[model samples]
Target: MISIQRSQHSPIGLQLGPSSATLVQLAGSRQNRVVHAIAQEQFELDEKQSIEERDANIAAQIRQILSDHHFKGRHVISCLGSQELFIQNVRLPQLPVDEIAKVVAWEAEERLPYPLAEAELRHLPAGQVRQESNTKQEVILLACHTGILKRHLDLLEQAGLTAVAIDVEPSATLRCFHNSSNDVQTNATNCYLNFGDAATTVIFADQQNVLFLKYIMQGSNHLDHAVAENLDLPLKEAIRLRKIVTNSPTLDASDELHRSVIDSIRSILETISTEVENCLRYYKVTFRGKKLDQLIVTGNESSPWLIEFLSDRLSTECKMGNPFESLKCWPTSTSILERPGRWTTAMGLAMKEKSNS
Candidate 1:
């Protein structure tokens, strides 16, 4: 069964992506916290491999990564990929807390693309709204395919890890931002962007709730591919060049090849910028009169160039999100400040509080 309980002891937060896995461990409470460990690994699966063979390979890689990091816990909290879950916000007539679930489930049946019986559903009451004479409640609904959830659980079990809770990725990313931001209690709206290997997630939220969310099927991998094709370099070389560009802001424009690579990167950023603008426009239409206060970018793929470009393109203050901003790191812990974007989901998963249930 999928569980949502919290861990009193240190629990590992493991994020399994299409091409990588990230793990983070934290100890102590929110008031006084320390990062225990953080580690990431990339793995490959051959297209010709059988399903069982692929799973075994992934489990093996995870086991090795855990051992390498010396991660201390067996209990873990994990997140479902964006493609594996369906999330939506709905409004329902205000009712007793006990009656909300039934109505939300009924609404899910009508809105969700899949049959309700094949999905596991969860809902959180966001807030109340006044509609006509009656009050209405806004709820965020999340549903995951039962089969996909089971496969993830089984994979973890096979890797000798016990999953204590399963959360959606977008929510996990939002949690990281909310916990780390100094202005989290403010009423200003904030937008968060998390760029993954093959996808990017956009989340618009305020001090109290999530206002909008969307997933775009474009990310750093596209940039890597573009660079590879333009520079006639292997994928690994393209990735290395991309990192060099991100790390060195002052590129010597004298080199034709270097300029070409930069141009390709800019083109990809333009595509991402357009999508972000679209999301912002949608939010404006849905929540009239409220404007985004800032845009925060995170994820392994986030870079200096992308952040600056997006800031100018959107005409909104843009900054990098640090998942460890609020937490202290152990003296021996690896440098989390180096690539904070990659750990947002894992850190957020580690910050989960005990459920009332």
Candidate 2:
């Protein structure tokens, strides 16, 4: 959602995480787009650093990335990292568009873990739903704690960037495919799963418009944790084993170590799959509009093993998604985007049209 004056130009799309940043800029008309600039850098998060210090360091990193690339313009759009915001679809009596916000505030106070006064609340009217005999409005309610939201804007200002819009992960993730999904049948429902370092986002959409989304608390990092606990190894050591097994195409159940690693990873992935199943079930039961047509999965850790596991668990046509498929780019940009999953969120943010709503 937008919070400030909309930019007149195509601003940079910046995606920030706990330990890294990915920024993408695109130019040209909708029919002939090109990747203007793209880059990603990772940094170690030191627990000893205070929040202010941490943000400053991140801001410095953003500045460096900007200077080292061909990114133009200072206006940008951004998103809260994984688990940074709370999202839920709440039901209310049909109300005027201008009256939704006040009612949404009451709903937020009742549902949020934090107080109402401390939140930056926003709501979108997502059509009407049947509640027994009565029809109720379904509003997509979003709230990011004020402290976290302020910190996000602060970092943008520190890096000499103007924030035109600050979006959430699920919305940003869905927007990634907006430009390229026109040819698909709009009547059919589709799903988008975005895996990040700390969380995975599931978005259901039709013709690039989001129907609903779910933010799973688990991410790729959970794989490491599961392996460490299962194998009784140090966190770092477990990561070593996980890196090998997760991406390995050879999942020979006959091999001892491979079986052990796969089992360990499966324990956590199963839990994630269960969550996704529940999400899909909820969507079908609540919306009851259309059957799932496809599932597009993307992430930095979206390895063959992980994709295969998810596809087998989920009953749909699951495949990797490339957001830059329609964009022209040089080898330098292509090299960094070799694994397109990680760039989905950033590209989604950049793809957003300037809005006054």
Candidate 3:
């Protein structure tokens, strides 16, 4: 656990995930940075565990990760992933900055699934949109259950960490590749596809800021389960075999087992591809954004085959997203570089400066 070293130091990034806890600490200034991130499987809880038991188990897991890594800084910026969030892209008539929140609350009345009173709501400006001759401001309305947020904070408290801010995973992901489209900012846009465990996040942005965001409920886990069912293997074994097939660029088509695994996951692959198409089409038609220059892929389960499938479907170039740019790293942190994409959210959280928000 890295200790906060006055104002000049970056706060640690602590991502409290359902199955894993990722912690990252960034050292140095904006241009020159060094980062070390660790992702540890947290304690698995059964339904029988009481709330107190669950908290203690989870807190211990968080502490174990910190102790094993010896990362300093208890002050951290954390995030709420898709499962705990409800987000919508809505268009609103222009209004004074002071009155925007009120309008968002009103607009959310017809959109949010839950009563507005029971939710913690926040709105972010997603730039302007024009339809026919009318112009409206596009906003991303975000909501999380009040109790869910309380539990999040409670976990942080139990783990002896200070929450400088709470961020949504999409925001953290956007922060990781904000500058990805800068080179082609004037003519083309960049798409970020963060293939998470339970959901795949889609963000359309260019150079400086995020223009749109959406989530697909189906994620890499679906594919794993599909393979598991087909091979009659346990999930752990299925995941290992699937990863081996995906990581191997020269996977043998003649290998009967590998071929069967690929065949099993075809449906989920098609579903993800369709979702990507819908997101891209919506962004183009609504935002009137430029052509997509490239797709920036991330997440632990992302594969070379998935990238190829997407790239071919959209007729756009694709590549793995890289957030590490001028950062010095310790010799022992090679794993961070090896699977950097999986730690993108934590890295982005580490980059976020301290704020009450």
Candidate 4:
């Protein structure tokens, strides 16, 4: 929970995700060039209902959260993951920005499996490319079913929150990273692994360009379940232990508990590494970019040694991301600053809303 005072007075931005909502109350002072951001309470939801059912439940949950905090400012921005949005990067004749909508529509109709009428689309120019035949250019068109976008918007409105902008999660994640790190501004290529409860999302970006986005079935909870089964412990206990133990710190000599947990996670990481490597190879040949500089692990329960283990196995630098950057961390209350990496998506959403406002 970092507090910031910026140079300009901007309306507060609220970010809502599937599982949680993170709010940042902001104010700015011009003379000081400071951005004042106060992190509000985080509200977690079940978020496991069927898509249709999830919306109503989430709406209620959000309303209650706002009531609890007595929050009224409604300018909000939400994010949809790559899974929810269909994105395609295509090369086209260098055209004016006004012509891009029609061109992108034509390309989407030709490229996407879904019908153009069924999809709600938007496009952004990536950059110009030099081809042997001509100087071609590319644009990344982001599309999603109108129904899907509507559902998210409806949910927020039902929650009594104003939804101002809908952004892609990959873009939000990358923006959050760039805002936090000066190193990434130098055009370094890196992979961001977002481990959720049931799934892991990997977004690879070169500087500002998003190269690959995917969702993996495996995640931290999968490792917890494996450990629970192997140790014959309750699910709750297994979860508690999972956050504490790593390859270096095995449980005990008599019990193979430590080995079991490490082995389970190692296997999962290996499978993910293979998939990542294949994606990297494709980008390397297609785009002719630098090799992957490192991998950043982020999630609620990211263990320190798990980062070490994966770094060793993948032969890449594995560092935990800091979700609490560009803000002032409260000294008296340490809970918000603790485990900040896991809040990357939520924090990114909050940051995006602030920027957009």
The TM-score values for the models, in the order shown, are 0.86, 0.85, 0.88, 0.74
C-alpha lDDT of all candidate models, in order = 0.78, 0.77, 0.76, 0.63
Candidate 3 global CA lDDT score: 0.76
Find the number of clashing residue pairs for candidate 4.
12
Query: In model 4, which runs have C-alpha deviations exceeding 4 angstroms?
Result: 1-53, 69-72, 91-99, 128-138, 179-187, 197-199, 217-260, 263-266, 289-292, 328-332, 353-357
Q: What lDDT tens digits, residue by residue, belong to model 4 across residues 1-357? A: 998854343333444544445554334331222224434343333446576677777677767766665544666666765456777778889888788899889999988768899998887665555567577676777889887778778887887777767776566566667744334543678888776655677767776576656667676567778878877888678866766564233245355656666665667777867776676565565555457787887765455665766677667788877655544442234655555665566556556534341
Query: Could you tell me which 10 consecutive residues in candidate 4 have the lowest summed lDDT?
Result: 26-35
**Mind giving the per-residue lDDT tens digits that candidate 2 earns over 1-357?**
978964333689888877668888887765666777788877556679998888888888789899899688888999887578888888899888888998999889899999999999887666666778888887888888999888889989999999989987767766656546444445667788888878888888765556676778787678777888988998778877766775566577787878888788776678878999998887787676568888888876665666677888987678777777645543354456555777888888887775522
Model 1 steric clash pairs: none
Worst 10 residues of 2 by lDDT: 326-335
Model 1 TM-score?
0.86
**Each model's total of backbone clashes:** 0, 0, 7, 12
Backbone clash pairs in model 1 (N, Cα, C under 3 Å; residues 3+ apart or in different chains), count: 0
Full candidate order by lDDT, most accurate first: 1, 2, 3, 4
Q: Tens digit of lDDT per residue, candidate 3, span 163-259?
A: 9899988778767665432333434578888877778898887654667888898776787889999989988888878877877555578998779
Greater-lDDT candidate between 1 and 3:
1
Q: Write the per-residue lDDT of candidate 1 for residues 41-124, one digit (tens) a residue.
A: 778768699878888899999999889988886888998887777888788876899998999899999998889999999886
